[model samples]
Every structure is written in structure tokens, then in C-alpha cells.
Target: MATVAATSYVMYVILRRDLQTKLGWPLGAVCTQAAHAASASMWIFRNDPNTEAYTSNLDSMHKVTLGVDSEEEIKKVADKLTARNVDHKVWIEDGFPVCIALKPYPKEEVKNALKGLKLF
Candidate 1:
């Protein structure tokens, strides 16, 4: 009998480039937004099996930060993920969408949904 290896899990963070370019937010501010989204997503999905597996091996946990051009782009991605039933959270501040974070999932399962996005 052969055994298959478990798929590695990862969290994906998406931020809007305009947060800095148009809003003139400092780099630290942008980073803070991403952090907030990531944290919220992890907490929201903490009970999920994949989140458990991903966090159990702290050294192996992975996160990828991607960028979008504007708020519209961010909402588009959020809608797409929702349509696909992907677990994620869109962080909003002052009534504006700041960024988004996807809960831990097999990289292959969510990579396609992020196609065309660039690293932040």
C-alpha cells in the first residue's frame, strides 16, 4: 500500500495598490491593513481543518501577498472568491475595503482564483 502526502496549506492576502499610490498611505499603513486582514481571516476560520493543519506546523505555514490596482479590483476578486465558495474575509475600515485574506487552503485550490494578480 502507498500513502499520499498531505497538501500544504497557505493563506493569501490581497491589497489594493491605490492604498498607497492614490490615498498616500505610508508603507507601514498598507502593511498594517494586510496584517489585519490576515489575522481576521485566520481567526474566522480557526476551526477549519486546513487552518488547524496549517497552524500546527508553524514553521511550514505560508502566506502570499498580492496586489490589485483599485478598490474595484479588490471587490471583483472578493466576488469571484465568494462565487467559488472560498473562505475569505474582506477587511473594511472607515467604510472602505482595505484588503482581503483567504483562509488556509491547498495552494492549488485557490491559486487559479488569484490569477493575473501581482505580488505586493
Candidate 2:
């Protein structure tokens, strides 16, 4: 059995589902947007307390990836998070938004903000 690491913090990665279905983007390219969103958010909030704690134990760091139906859907989530002062980054490709990643934060503090998303 694999070990489960306990931690209070989590990184939320939200990607556009249409990238694969409607947009016909290659899998690798879609994955790259996720990478860009995550890394950029991590760098931007590197100094946050939760981020510091989350990175301190890299092996146990927790991440949750969710999917949205379209660019507008993803942007809606980002707006909600921004209203709550939740640190995050939205990645844009070719002038269209495709992904959003939230900085590490206690799961409880951010769960409701992400309650509407489905696992990717």
C-alpha cells in the first residue's frame, strides 16, 4: 500500500476541459498549461506562510487538480478566488485563459472556493 502523508495545506490546479474535447489541443500542450499555472503561482506566492510550510516537505506536499468546462468557467473561478484574496495565478495561452492554480493554503480555508470543480 502507498503511504498517505498528512498535511493541512493544498495546491489547487484548475484546467479547462475543452482543451482536449472542443479545442482539440494535444495532451502535452494542455499539460504544459497546467505546469505554467502551478509553477507561476508557486513562485508568486513563495513567501506565503502556507506555501513555505507546504514546500518544506516536498515529498508530502498535497495538490488537487480540478477541471472546468470552458475558458469562462475557469475565469469565473479565478474571479471568486481573487475576491476572497486567495493567492493564485491564471495561465493564458495564445491570448486565451486555460488554467488557474492557487497557492498552497490550508485545505479548509479554500475548499469552498473549489467546491464546484470536478477532478480532472
Candidate 3:
């Protein structure tokens, strides 16, 4: 019999590109939003096994930041993640959605869910 090693966990942060092009938000503000989303998700899933593995390996912790076009697009992604029962946090500012952070998950487990997004 043979055994396979589990895939390493990854955290995915999706930000709204419009924050810059449409809203004229500075790079620092956009970065802050991403940080807020990532921190919130990590705190919410702190006890999750995948999160535990990801955090314990700080030097190799994997995080991907992708970009969506607008708030509607981000909401759609959040909805899909919710339907798949993926743990995540959606950060809103001034009553509008800014970005989202998905809890650490095996790369293969959440890869398809992020299709169509581009690197931030």
C-alpha cells in the first residue's frame, strides 16, 4: 500500500481592483483592506487544522492575493465559497465590500473556486 502526503494549506485573499481604478483608493488603503480580511479570517479559523498547519509553518506560509473587478464580483465569489462551506471572512468598509479572505485550505480543495481572478 502507498500513502500520499496531504497538500500544504494556503490562504487566498481576493481584493476589488476597482478600489484603485474606480474608487481612486491609494495602494496603502488597498493593502490595509487585504490585511484586515486576512487577519479576520485567520482569527475566525484559528483552531482549524489547516490554519494550525499554515501558521505553524510561518516561514513557508502561503498566501495568494487575487483581484476581482468590483463589489458584485467579490460578492459572487463569497457566495460560492459559502455554498461550498469554505471558511472565509468578507471585509467591508464604509458600508461597501472591500475584499475577502479564505481560510487556509488544501491548494486543490479551493483552486477551482478562484478561477477568473488575477494576481493583485
Candidate 4:
């Protein structure tokens, strides 16, 4: 029998819930916001050790998809993450911030700032 070291890294992909609930965006369109942010975050931090580790195991990548009620709420979370020095990307379309994606990191390192969000 063989054992592998435990990996606790994850990428947080947050979507603006209002886009679908209040603004009437299609599910596909809103999900695309999350996809764009996640992709950008991964690409931008491709060389980071945590990202490398997270991607190294393609069969076991971990991601948390969360939702914020409005633009203000989402931006607040982004600001909080920024204050904490967490790396993330705020996806923008037509100059409006649509979603946020954080670079892959140890779950314990980034979960606090995101504790309030609900799964999307």
C-alpha cells in the first residue's frame, strides 16, 4: 500500500448572484463569468507553487463556487481579500465587475475572507 501527502489547496470562484436573479442573465452567461475569472486567475498565477500543485493533479483539482448577492457585496469581498494580500482576479465585462476568482492557495489561507459567501 502507498500513501500520498494531503493537499489542501483550492481555487475560489465567486459569481455575482444579482446578474441572474435581478438582472435576468441566462445561466450559461452567468456561469461564463465564473469560468472567465477562474481561467484568468489560473493563467495569471501559473507559476505559483500552490497553483502548480493544484493543477499538477488534474484528476483532483478543488474549486469552490460561491455567490454574492450584489455588486457591492462582491466588491466588498474582493476588497477584503486584497487587504489580506490574497491574489485574485475580478472579472470585468463592459467595464463592470462580474465575478471574482482567487489564485489557488491552501484552504486555510483564504477561507476566512470567503466564509460568508454561499455556494452558487
Candidate 5:
């Protein structure tokens, strides 16, 4: 299911490149995945491939952006993660969601652990 969801997400981006122009950024998938993980970890352990819940949350943020049109969206994402007890650092460039830095977590070590597990 995870693989299917990941694939669908990639395909969605591929099919929506034109739309992504205004709503695009480098590492958008990574950012979206991070967003999903952050939100899902907060609400519950949503392991389902169905994206209704996660996309709903993203839609809510998008709606809010329609009015504020500032850092509100990015801040809201970070705030949601923080409110849910997820320790993360966020960087927003030019009002778009940029890099999300997990606080105090050895990302390289985590990647190494995943590699050791042969998950990649």
C-alpha cells in the first residue's frame, strides 16, 4: 500500500507539471511526504494508502493560503507538526514550503539504519 501510494503521488506530480508551475518547488515530493508523515504521526498512525485524510489536511492549508497569501501556509504546516509533538525545523523561501529540517535527529544515521535494513 505504501508503495502504491508513493507511486500514485509521483504520477500525480508527473501529470500535473503545468499546475505545479505556480505550486511547484524542488523536492516537492519529499516535502509532501514529510508533510504527510508529520500530520499522520500527529493525528494517528495512518498507514492506509488512501490519501483522503492527508490531502484534506493539505487542502485546508491551501484554502487558508487563498486568503492570507503569506507565510501562513508554511507556518501552519510547521505549527501543525509542532502542535502534534513532532520536533522539526522549517525553512520557507519566497512564501513556498521549502526545506523541512528535523530537529536534533541524525538523518544520515537514520538513512544508514534504513540501508542496513535493506529497505532501499
Candidate 6:
């Protein structure tokens, strides 16, 4: 058990670094890393704190179904979020934002979603 635990910890660290450098995803953003003791407690990092770029991106892509007029716009939003390594989900009825819950989230996205943006 001890050996397995130690090995897991080492692998986790290595993978975290690789993912960040390769995919630009923050260590905490990944579910595996986030589930760990160390990475789970880390502080949130943001490139733009004043925007809902993350939520908007997820909502735009995952929430909306195909054949909508706003598909282009939503795709753009999703692209932006992907560029930033943000993950989210969208609603089929109305481009609602679904996302992983985290502490100290991008305040701007919360505010934007709060304004009748439909977040879940």
C-alpha cells in the first residue's frame, strides 16, 4: 500500500507538469489532479478575472444544440475557453453554462451568468 501510494504521488506530479506545459491546462483544472490532497487545495489562477470567459465558453458549446443561428457565436466562445484551458458544459434548450465547481472562481463569469445567463 505504501509503495503504491508513493508511486501514485510521483506520477501525479509528473503528469500535472506535462499537462500544463502541453495543454495549457492549470493543474487544478484537471479532475485527477484536483482530486489529490495537494493540488486540490491550491489557489485559483486566472488570466482575466473580470470576464466570464470560462463559463461563457462552456455554456456556448455544451449547452446549445446544433442548427441554431447562434451556433457561430457559441463556437467562438468555446474556442476562447479552450484556448484558456477552461472546461464547461452547455444546456440544450438555452446556452446555459455547466462547469466544475471550484473555489475563488472567475467572479466575472459568475456575475455574467447570474444576469439571467442560466448556469448550472
Tell me the spans in candidate 6 whose CA falls farther than 4 Å from its real position.
Answer: 1-69, 92-104, 108-120
Clash pairs detected, candidate 6: 52-109, 62-90, 63-90, 63-91
Between candidates 5 and 6, the one scoring higher on lDDT is 5
46-95: candidate 1 lDDT, tens digit per residue: 99988887888677778889999898999999999999999999999779
For every model shown, what is its TM-score relative to the native structure? Answer: 0.92, 0.92, 0.92, 0.92, 0.26, 0.24
- Worst 10-residue lDDT window for candidate 4 reads 1-10
Question: What's the lDDT for candidate 3?
Answer: 0.89
Question: Candidate 2 on 29-77: residue-level lDDT in tens?
Answer: 9899999999999999999877888888888888888999998898899
User: In candidate 3, residue 3 scores what lDDT?
Assistant: 32
Each prediction's total of clashing residue pairs, residues at least 3 apart in sequence or on different chains, is 0, 0, 0, 0, 0, 4
lDDT of 4 by residue, 1-120 (tens): 753322568888989889989999999999888999999999999998778878877888888899888888888988998999999999997688899999988888887888878998
Positional deviation of residue 44's Cα in model 5 after best superposition, in angstroms: 26
Clashes of 1: 0
Per-residue lDDT of model 6, residues 18-115, tens digit only: 23454565655543433442223222323433122333343331111121123344445445545665433322222332122232233344333223
Task: Kindly report which residue stretches of model 1 are placed more than 4 angstroms away from their true locations once superposed.
Answer: 1-7
lDDT of model number 6:
0.30
Q: Which candidate would rank higher by TM-score, 1 or 2?
A: 1
Candidate 1 vs candidate 5: which has greater TM-score? 1
| Cα RMSDs, all models | 2.1, 4.4, 2.4, 2.7, 15.9, 17.5
TM-score of 5: 0.26
Candidate 4 segments whose C-alpha is farther than 4 A from its true place: 1-7
In order, candidate lDDTs are: 0.89, 0.88, 0.89, 0.88, 0.34, 0.30
Local error of candidate 2 at residue 59 (angstroms): 0.9
